[model samples]
Target: MEPIKISGILSIILGLIFIIFPVFSSGVVSIIIGISLFFFGITLILAGFTASNIIIGILAIIFGLLFTFNIDAVSFLLGFQFYIIGIILLLAGIIGLISDTQISKIASVLIIIMGIISFALGGFSIGNPLYAAILIGVCLIIQGIGMLLD
Candidate 1:
C-alpha cells in the first residue's frame, strides 16, 4: 500500500483507540508530551543561547519532570492546558472579529463561544478531558478519511 494510505489507516485506528479509551489515551498523550518537553529543555540548556533561554529551559525541565513523574501533576497540567487553549481561541476570535468579512464575523462568534466554554470547563475541572478526547478522536477519523480519499 501507499504511504499515505498506510498513515490514513493508522490514523483511523488511533482515532478509534482515543474514542474507546479516552482516559488512557489522554494519560499516554500527557506522558509523551512530558517526555518531549524534558528533552526539549535539555536541548535548550545545552544550546545556552541566552540567560532567558536558560531560565525558560530550567522551568521547562522542572515542569517536565513533574508531569512525567507525577500523575496528579499531569491531571493538573491537563486543566492548565485547557486554559491555555481557551486563551488562544479567545484571542483568535477577537482577531477574527477585527476582520471586515462576514464569514470571519460568524466564525469569530463561534470561536468566542467555544473559548468561553473551554475556559469555564477548565475553571470547573469538569469532564473536559473526556470531551476533548472524544472530540479529538472524531477529528482524527475525519482527517484519516480525507487522507484516504485524497
Candidate 2:
C-alpha cells in the first residue's frame, strides 16, 4: 500500500529468503543474532537495576548463542520441546476427561478423537512408505521358489 510499508515488507521477504537459504548470505542471520546478543547483553547486564529483567536478558543472550552457534541443535531441541508439549496436551486432555464440566467434556472428546486419528494416520504413512517395495520383494521371492521347483 504505502511506500514505507511496501519497502518494509520487501525487506522482510528478502530477509526470510536469506535466512532460509543461508548459503546466499553465508549464515549472516545467525551471525547477526550472535552479535546482537553479545552487545545487547552487555547493556542489559550493566543496567542491573532489576534482577528479573536481567535474567530474561541473560536467557535471551544464551538463546541467541544457541541459535547462532548450534543451529541444528536448536532445531532438534525445538522439535523435542514440541514433542513434549504434544504429550503434555494429551495428558491434559485425559485429565479434562477425568473431571467433567460442560465444555471440557466436548473438548476432551474431540482431543481424544484427534489423537486417535493422528496416531492411525501417522502409523499408516510411516509404517508403509515402502509397501510396494515390500510387496514386490515378496512376489519375486515366491516366483523364484516356484521357478526353482519347476
Off by over 4 Å in 1: 71-74, 82-127
TM-score of 2: 0.34
TM-score of each: 0.63, 0.34
Error of 1 at 98 (Å): 25
RMSD to true structure for each model, in Å: 8.2, 18.6
| Top candidate by TM-score | 1
Which candidate number has the best lDDT? 1
lDDT values for all models = 0.68, 0.47
What pairs collide in candidate 1? Answer: none
Across 71-125, the per-residue lDDT of candidate 2 in tens digits comes to 6756544213223223333543564577533336878677566556434433432
Residue-pair clashes per prediction, in order, are 0, 0
